[model samples]
Target: MTKHRVRTVERYTRRTRWYHAAVYITVLALLGTGWWLLTGREGEPSPAARLTGAADVTLHTYAGWVLTGLTAVAITLGARAARTFVVESVRVDKGDLRWFIRWPVAVVTGRFSHHRGHFDPGQRVANLVLVTLLAALVASGVGLTMVVGGPGFVWLQRVHRWATYLITPVLAGHILIAAGLLPGYRGVARAMHLGGRLRVDTARRVWPGWLDRRLAEDDKQPARAEGDSPD
Candidate 1:
């Protein structure tokens, strides 16, 4: 096998890596308990509830709070940096449009590609939806837990349930992509776990436009300095 030249590129900041871990872990906790809570109740214990016992409800409730706290902390700590990430990931352009149309088809057909993106358009859009769902879940969960029976508190519970229904599948997809189960994606988890360094070749494939732009800037720096130097 021919060896390709490799480089280490900074992919995620320390805070970003930790925050991502916290969010996913908390979300997973919330989902697990939430599923059991949804299926099983005091009088009518579903299989999940039967297996887990009374602890599931308690766990579910606390998990929601934990999720809320983690999300808030992430925002507080990373808002400034997050703005850059959001801009890079969420912005739609011609490349994103092209990638989305072909990429979705490719994924479904089992002919996948590591197409260009700062963040893949599909992932960016899906993340936006998930974020919106998370906000709804947090708000409704707080209303249900804190109010606990005030006017429309049942409605709050309803909203939270609905939001979670949407969140569950989307989260599953996100995990598949991160786990590298999705075709053409060999998981992006390494950056979050292993010092946030991305393999330059992989980064180039997935984020070619961003890589190119950065490379262009790098190239210009020497030229700029040379022009500035006294002849």
Candidate 2:
């Protein structure tokens, strides 16, 4: 007799995927444009830098508009769900505290292991802070870019400049956190590299309640003898 294995179906909604991809790509473009604007070389800019810089900065401006549009769409389509994610991610619970303590202990002893479920309370808190910071950064950046043409307050300009500097460390810490979860997180990176699809396990782990239910269902079917029929 052959034994059947259960497979889980886990994935992001197409709209959610679109939202994440657009935000990240535009973020990279914004970073590139910001780098050039801050640290352009003396004399005429190199053709490569000139073209890339112009294209990216333009894209970044429009991308901010796109992000605003997407945010509206998300609120419309899944207002409740989005709000729940926002709330849960921001709530610093006892679990997060425990996780924090365990993480360092595990790291020191070379036994770093974590629960295999959805984002922990700590991760949710970090994600919420990151998203809020990113939104503020984008808003300030848009205003700063329009300074030449629009109303630009000196203090606002300085705030935008300092925001970029501060956000760099936050972004670095985010990357380091992901790296620490590489065993589970590598596929999130791969999903982009492969254009959305990833190993099923990765998706299940990333979105446990949403996708892992299928696996649970798979496990509950009763085994039958070779010739037995359903009653």
Candidate 3:
């Protein structure tokens, strides 16, 4: 029997994967504790609170702070990548509407329509919604911490709660897809986890345009290096 080599592509950088992990972990922490407090468990000590020796509110506040700090750092240090992410997320491709039309059936059939961008049409919508919701949550949370009792406080509280309510389902759907629960998205999680790579076939299927561009870039490297060599 002959051994065969499997080809793979790096879909995400290590820094990108680490940033994603940090953001999700912090967001989950905030959501868990915030919901616990909102659901009348304010004074009650859950297992996590007991383990950490902190109240639900304290944990939630600290998690929010961590998330805020992470966002600040990303915006400042990863400005270029952040700009690219926003631009890609908001860009409308010619066939985006058609892509969305096909996506529902394609989820089960594993026959996604070809799209031209870093994100699929569904992901573009998700990115915009998720970022907006997260920004609202962060802003409202910070305002809540500052304002004690007033109309401003009440307004911030409402924003925070509504943002949470909205983000929970959106985040859940994102998780379901990213977890590879959908047939067409199977093996997709490898792009953000497990060394941030995916089989070439998987990459090609899920991100044909991106994969083609990446391959083209790869093909130019050796020729460029050879041209730069001393004669």
Find the candidate with the highest lDDT and give its number. 3
What TM-score does prediction 2 earn?
A: 0.65
- Cα deviation at 97, candidate 3, in Å, is 1.0
Clashes per candidate (backbone, < 3 Å): 1, 1, 0
Please, what are the lDDT tens digits per residue for candidate 3 over residues 85-185? 99999999898888889999999987889998998889989999999999999999999999999999999999999999999999999999998899999
The C-alpha local distance difference test score for the whole of candidate 3 amounts to 0.87
Expressed as tens digits, the lDDT of each residue in 1-231 for candidate 2 is 877543323244456666777766666555655655566532345344576664544655666676667667667987976887776665554344665666655434433234333565446766777677676766776676667643465655666567667666776766655444544354545343333444565555444453455456546653223233323
Ranking of all predicted structures according to TM-score, beginning with the best and ending with the worst = 3, 1, 2
Cα error, candidate 1, residue 131 (Å):
0.4
Q: What's the TM-score of each model vs. the native?
A: 0.78, 0.65, 0.94
Worst lDDT window (10 residues) for model 1? 222-231
> What is the Cα-based lDDT of residue 195 in candidate 3?
73
lDDT of 1 by residue, 80-162 (tens): 87677667667766655667667766554534344445676787888789878999998888888667576698788889889
Q: Model 3, 145: alpha-carbon shift in Å?
A: 0.8
lDDT of 3 at 32: 93
What is the TM-score (0 to 1) of candidate 1?
A: 0.78
Cα displacement (Å) at residue 152, model 1: 0.7
Better of 2 and 3 by lDDT: 3
